[model samples]
Target: MKIGIISDSHDNIDAIAKAVEILNNSNVDLTIHLGDIVSPFCFDWFKKLRSDFLGVFGNNDGEVLFLDKKSEGVLHKPPFEVEIDRKEFILMHEPFGIEKLKTQYDYVLYGHLHKVDIRKTDRGCIINPGELCGCLTKKRTMVILNTTDNQTQLITV
Candidate 1:
């Protein structure tokens, strides 16, 4: 199964649209947003995704109720745990205690610093797909993970 990962979009509709196109074309089985979506209106782009999607709330996501509604209840508070393709995964908006969490799940994914971070551990991987908004790094990025082999491709969208 292929999983699409993105974070810190910061209301960049263009970038988000591009990322969604890429993910859709890539035929990802699931798409995970690491938050910082900023506003509910961004759903205009997110709704275009062709695969199943979910997300966690970032610090900047103030309209929690609307975000949840827009996401159709797929958006949740940070540090959410999910099992996909028989792999245990933890999703959070902030990279807090990731080292500790890594030991417990097959993947510890987070966003917040607006930087790309990918670390392979003995058990699994720790990944942050970076800022889709290109606000801090001046580069829009995302990730595609193959669950069968645990391989990841970092993509610039």
Candidate 2:
């Protein structure tokens, strides 16, 4: 399955819109966001863009009540082990937790550093799609993970 992965939008509407359009056109089976949904604007943009957003809570995320209310029916993989297609996947917003989880999952995806990172080991892989909003990085970015073949592509937003 083709999965759209994005992180740390930081309230960039135009970039998010473009990314959403690209993902929708790609006909991805689903989309996973690494959070940093900032505020109401961010939440609204994601809600209007598509329905396949599976995300998590980031450190800078504000408006918890609002986000929670809007996240109903949204499949948010917690900061824990989440299984997809019988393959173990771990999603979180912080990276430090990875040291312990590296051995537990087939893949680990996270955000918060605003940098694109993809690494592998004898056991599994870890991926970060970077900041879609260009928060800390001047280059806006996102990632497309093709689960069918275990490959990932980075796109500049």
Best by lDDT: 1
Which sections of candidate 2 miss by over 4 Å? 48-51, 73-78
TM-score of each: 0.98, 0.89
C-alpha RMSD by candidate, in order: 0.6, 1.9
Model 2: weakest 10-residue lDDT segment is 72-81
Superposed Cα deviation of residue 139, candidate 2 (Å): 0.9
Model 1: residue 124 alpha-carbon error in angstroms: 1.4
Query: Could you give candidate 2's per-residue lDDT for residues 1-157 as a string of tens digits?
Result: 7788898888788988888888878787778888787775565666655436678878777776677677664535358567765678888888866867778788899998998898775555688998898857788888888776778888887
> What residue runs in model 1 are displaced by over 4 Å at the alpha carbon?
none
Best by TM-score: 1
- Error (Å) of candidate 2 at residue 98 is 1.9
The per-residue C-alpha lDDT of model 2 at residue 93 equals: 86
What is the lDDT, from 0 to 100, of the residue 117 in candidate 2? Answer: 93
lDDT of 1 by residue, 1-157 (tens): 9999999999998999899999999999999999999999999889999999988999999999999998999998988999999999999998899888988999999999999999998777999999999999999999999989989999999
